[model samples]
Structures are given as C-alpha cells and as structure tokens.
Target: MLAWPAWLTILLLVTNLLSLAALFFVTRRMLKLRRQKKRAFAFSDYPVRKAKLEEIAPCFAMSGYGPSPDSEVRFIGGEGVVSSLSDRESWVMAALAKGVKRVFEFGTCSGKTTHVLALNAAPDSEIFTLTLHPDDLAATEFGFGDDREHRDIALSESSFETFYYNGRSSERHIRQIFSDSKSYNEAPLRGSVDLVFVDGAHTRSYVENDTRKALNMLADEGVILWHDYKPGVPGVFAFLNELSRTLPLVHIADTDLVMYRRVRKQLSPA
Candidate 1:
C-alpha cells in the first residue's frame, strides 16, 4: 500500500544499518590483526632446537638412572589441581632438583612444584619460591600490551594464600616469599642460584622481566627452565622464540618446557 518513494526510503535505511554492522565487525577484525602484527614485529620466531630428555642432563639417561634413587621423586597427581604440569614434566624437574643445592622459582601456583623440588633436593638444599600474595593482587602491574587473557589467568592463579607445602616436612627447606615478582629484590641472590624456574605471569612483559632476573640469579653452571612454551601461549612462545636467537635454548620434546643451561668456561693453562 506504500508509495514507491517511501518503500525505497525504507530499503535505504535498512541497507545503511546493515552496512554499519558489517563495517563494525570488519574494523574489529582488522584491529585484532594489527595487534597480532605488532606482537609479531616485536618478537620474531627463531628456530629453537627440540632436544631429547637425556640430551639435557645425564640424570635423564636410562643408563644413568634405571630405577635408582637419583631419579626417584615424590609426586602428586594433577587431579583437581589448577594448571598442573604433566607427569613427565614433573618427573624431569624432580630429577633435576636432586642435584641442585639452591633453587629459585618465579611462581608457586599451589606449591605443588615447590614441594616436589624440596622432596628431591639434597637435605640441606634451600628453595625460594615466590608468588603474589592473594591480598596484594591490587599491586600487580600488568603492561598495556600484555595479553589480557593471561593477565586474568595470572590473577586467578595468585588466589592461593596457603600452598600445598604448608605443614609438610619439606616446608622446612622451602622459603615462600609473598610479593609481586616485579617488586621482588633479586640483588642479594644474584649469581647464587643453582636452578631457576620461570613460571610466573605468562604475559610478555612479566616473562621478560622474570627471565632477566632469573639470568641474574643463576650461578655458574646453573640451569633455567621456562614453562608454557607452546604457540597457544602467545606471550611465552613469542618471547622465547625471540630469545632463542641469542641463547642456547632447547625445547624439550613432548613437553611445554624450554631449558637453558649456563656452562662455566674452563680457564686455559698458561
């Protein structure tokens, strides 16, 4: 019943709204691509060698520890635990802990890893594990360019005030530090840690900051292990891929851990 002019006007209005909706979605997608491009530009992929377990340390060799005490470790299953490491990864870390005297951990999600480290370390060994205090979440300083999803994950993981090691015999060897890693002082412990585990916030800025401090804390011949190296973790994957260009980093096959060992140079005889 409407005039042709009025019908044409209605069609024009509907077309205009649909065009705007399409433009909005397109703009959103373009912005996402721009952010990803910026991240790629900031951190380029460098080939990281995938290494077998035995290649990283002799303790992992079948000949070296065929059901021996050196490779034995106390372990808790990943059941009901948040962000737990795979069984194989846990065993690898535990075996490595057996030979180290001083261990530094960047993040203690539930103190499960900390407990395992203490249980395997030498009786006199000291373990320092740092995590954000649940009460101090407000003090976290996430960078503007950090992955928003991981920022939320970091906060969620910091919700633990008490950890699995609380009241266990291994707690005697463990020193739990409640402080944001960015504000934690590493000067006193520089060049003294035998092992460093970098598993803090997965955001790029936090990972970079923690890695810098981990390197500073490493002793001669110390080893540094970083968790969550898969491509899904954009911050960790990109940063580590970029880091592999300058450091001898090896991604352990079948696991998400990347490792770097600092070997002392032997002095030449005169």
Candidate 2:
C-alpha cells in the first residue's frame, strides 16, 4: 500500500467524524418526535356542555347543562380490564348515558365503555358495538384510502373474543357485531342514535369513515365522543386537528377524549 499524506489522512478523519455527528443528530430527532406531545386544542368552541357535579359531593346536581332529571345515571366501578376510562372520562360517560335509549360504539376492544354505557343508560337502552373478529382478519383489506400502519395496529388489537361486559347484566343491552366496521350498515340507524362512541381504528382513513357514519346515525342534539386524540398518534392527531378547523371539536383538558355535538339544522322558511 502507498503511504498517504498526513494532511489527506487528517481531512478523511474529519469528514468521517462530521458524518457520524450528522447521523447522531438525525437519530436523536427521530426519537424526540416519537416522544413529543402535540398541543391540546381548546374545549369551549365546540357545541358541548359541561356536566355539573357538586364540588363537595360526588353526586351530580341539576344545572342548565346537566343531564335530564329523568336520566338514570349509574356507575359500575372500573375493575379488571385491559383498558378502561379514567375517572373523569367515566363521569362524562355516566352523565351522558342518562336518559339515552340508543348508543353506538365503533370499537368494543375490552367492552369497558360498553359496560359504562349500559350501566348508566336507561333500563330500555340498547347498545350496538362493532368490532373485528379474529376469524375475519384474513378477509380484512387495506386499500389506498386506508393507512396500512394504523390498520395493522387495529387488527392486532382487535383479537379479543371475550369482553369485560360478557356474562354481566349489561350484556343483555349490548349487541356485539363481529365484522369489519367499514362494511357495517349504518342506513337503518340514520338519525336515530342518541350517543356515539368512536374509539375504533386510530388511522386517518378509519377515523374519517367512522365519523361520517356517526354523523349519519346521530339524531338531533346527539353527542359523539372520540378516544386517543393525543399528539404522537399521528393518524388520530392529524385527522382531528384538520377536522376541528371545519367542525366544532372540543378536546377535554388532560384526557384523550374529544367531544362533538350534533346540532339539528332548521329548514329554511317556505
């Protein structure tokens, strides 16, 4: 081998060092993105009303914005479950369940929310939840309109055959449908649902599809709640951020829940 000039050797070493530094910065940036928290949106602009609970007591009190007087609000404690709502989120669900007769849920993961809905809703209330069955996973397809990563994650998380509500009293009120949410028929339920919980796929495409169906199925003055509206969840964060600009989407402070109320549009005067 030929001897290299000392100057040339030093130049090569410096170039290699610079290259390593660049790589280090890029890697750090990627990891930082993974941990970064997105800014939370405001909660006042949406058509949502807060439920009033007496500061001294845990009981809900009558307020202009509180649940109707006839609503039967109940709480089944959050015990063993894969995933469940926070106390704050539970309060919101229980308060809204009062007097509601029809509820629709997009994802039934562990059925924790379904149990909450059934426990608080009226005795005659009916809940319909849609989730993918493990057997149907082979048939599920991801198209150009869907986010492959989100879809895959959803599939992996949808493998539960048993739910928290199974064998419980609330099971009588829940009608679990084992199928892909995209193919579920929302036509018959149009304008009939009192509350809709959209906790399904976190992908942008799935969120869009579920939101469209929820809007169609909601009755006048109905409410819709979405889960996992955090920043690092790219699909959910991006879709919700853009949708909030067009629609009044309120993010509750400190929780991943976002609320949207459907206001009935009055027809133009004849």
Candidate 3:
C-alpha cells in the first residue's frame, strides 16, 4: 500500500515499455546470428589450381572441410569436420559465390586474394581490388634469366603479372583485374563496390578505418565480410556491435569466417 501520483504511474508504464522493446531487439539479433539455417559453401570439389587442390586434401583429412570465407567451414562427410581453406582462397570464393559482380577488397598480403578474384569472375565482370604494395617495389624472383643487374626490373614486372594468376587458368573463365595503386581509404572506387571484404590491418584503428571506407563504398546489394573473427578476437566484434542506430547488419559466424550482410536497405531520398 503506497501512495503514487497519476502522472508517475504513466511514466513507469512508458519506462517498462521501452525496456521491453530493447530486450526484444537484442534477443532477435542474437537468434539471427546463432539460429540461422541457410548456409553456403558446405562442400565443393571444383578448384582453381592444382596446387590448391593438393593442399586441401592433406589439410582436411580429418575434418573434410577447409576454412571458408563465410559461415563455419564444411567437410565432405563422415565426421570429416574438414579443415579451413587458406584464408586467402576462402575470401575469393565467398565473393564470387555471393553473386557479386564487382568486388572491393583491402589488404593484399602477398597479393593472394587479389589473385583469387582474378580466378573466379564471370567472362566480362570487372574486379577492382586494391593493395598497398607498390608496382615498382623491389622483390625477389627465381628462375629469371641470369642477369643480376636487370633482375630487379624483371622481378617487378613479373610480380605484377603473378598478382593476377586467376585469369590464366586454362579450365575456368576469369576476368582481368589488376591491383590498384591506391590507398584503401582514398581509392577512387566510391559507391561502386558490389562486395567489400576487409582482412587487412587487424588492429583496432586500422580495422575501423577500413570498415568506415568500405561502408561508404559498399553497393546496395553488397555484402561485407570481416576476416579472422575467432571467438577470442577483440576489435572486430566491437566494430560490428557498435552504432546499432545505423548500420543495420546481420552477422554470420563460423570457425574462421564472420560475415555481415545488409539484408534490408536504409530508405533515404534519392
């Protein structure tokens, strides 16, 4: 038996209503990531290179799957559990399978993923990937003509060509995409990317910078996948979870891959 004012009673009701709404939202999202049933890339024998196939066989002997770009990796069968694909390969395949015609990526460590994009594009699709490695930078080359003084020039040119190995395969059809000599934040590909995947600079500051830039450039149908989101990683989870007011997102998590796709578009005046 306590005395309460009429206005105070209304205020309490409003507060409780707000609390319920917040709880509903959080629970809904948690279920979306955890209880999802539609997953891609469970098993496939198709491959880009002979070397890649050989590597996969030995690695996934127990698990039957490899680290993939999105979702938990899949194994062939029989508790195969499979192994993870080399992170670089997983990134490329995920982009292709997502029906992305144009892919924008950050970090070109050894230019592996860039090369992979060059491997999986439709006949005429354009792949615009970027990396910080300078085209004229000095690098080591083996099996070149034995001219020590001229070796540097040959190596630099060869490196450029090798970065696009995906287009050279005889069995598959790939598009020609060269590595752009631009910074990730200042690249010219604004508002024109179909898919954006960020695996470069795992540090918090660098990761945030890449993400901000990627968001601006991501296209209407584009999906953004963040590489290396293990159960224990720090900065990545923060970026995905912050700013719920904007950045409507759905996260898909597995052992090695974590993806956030824009399921619904933000309605703004065109």
Structural similarity to truth (TM-score) of each candidate? 0.80, 0.71, 0.47
Residue-level lDDT for 165 in candidate 1: 88
Instruction: Flag the better candidate by lDDT, 1 or 3.
Output: 1
Error of 2 at 252 (Å): 1.4
Q: Put the candidates in lDDT order, highest first.
A: 1, 2, 3
lDDT of 2 by residue, 31-150 (tens): 777655321233442332232343212344456977435444566665455546776677677777776899999989888888889988879999999998888887665557666767
User: Which candidate wins on TM-score?
Assistant: 1
- Indicate the TM-score of model 1: 0.80
Best by lDDT: 1
By TM-score, rank the candidates, best first. 1, 2, 3
Model 1 C-alpha lDDT per residue in residues 1-270, reported as the tens digit of each score? 955798888999999999999999999999999999998864444257889887888766666436444467778756557786898889888888885799999999989999999998889999999999889999899998799999999999998888898999999999999999999999999999999999999999999999999999999999999999987888899999899999999998888899999989899999
lDDT by residue (tens digit), candidate 3, 196-225: 767654445556667888878776666676
| lDDT per model vs. reference | 0.90, 0.78, 0.48
The candidate with the higher TM-score, 1 or 2, is 1
Model 1 per-residue lDDT at 72:
71
TM-score of 3: 0.47
lDDT at position 33, candidate 2: 72
Off by over 4 Å in 1: 1-46, 63-70
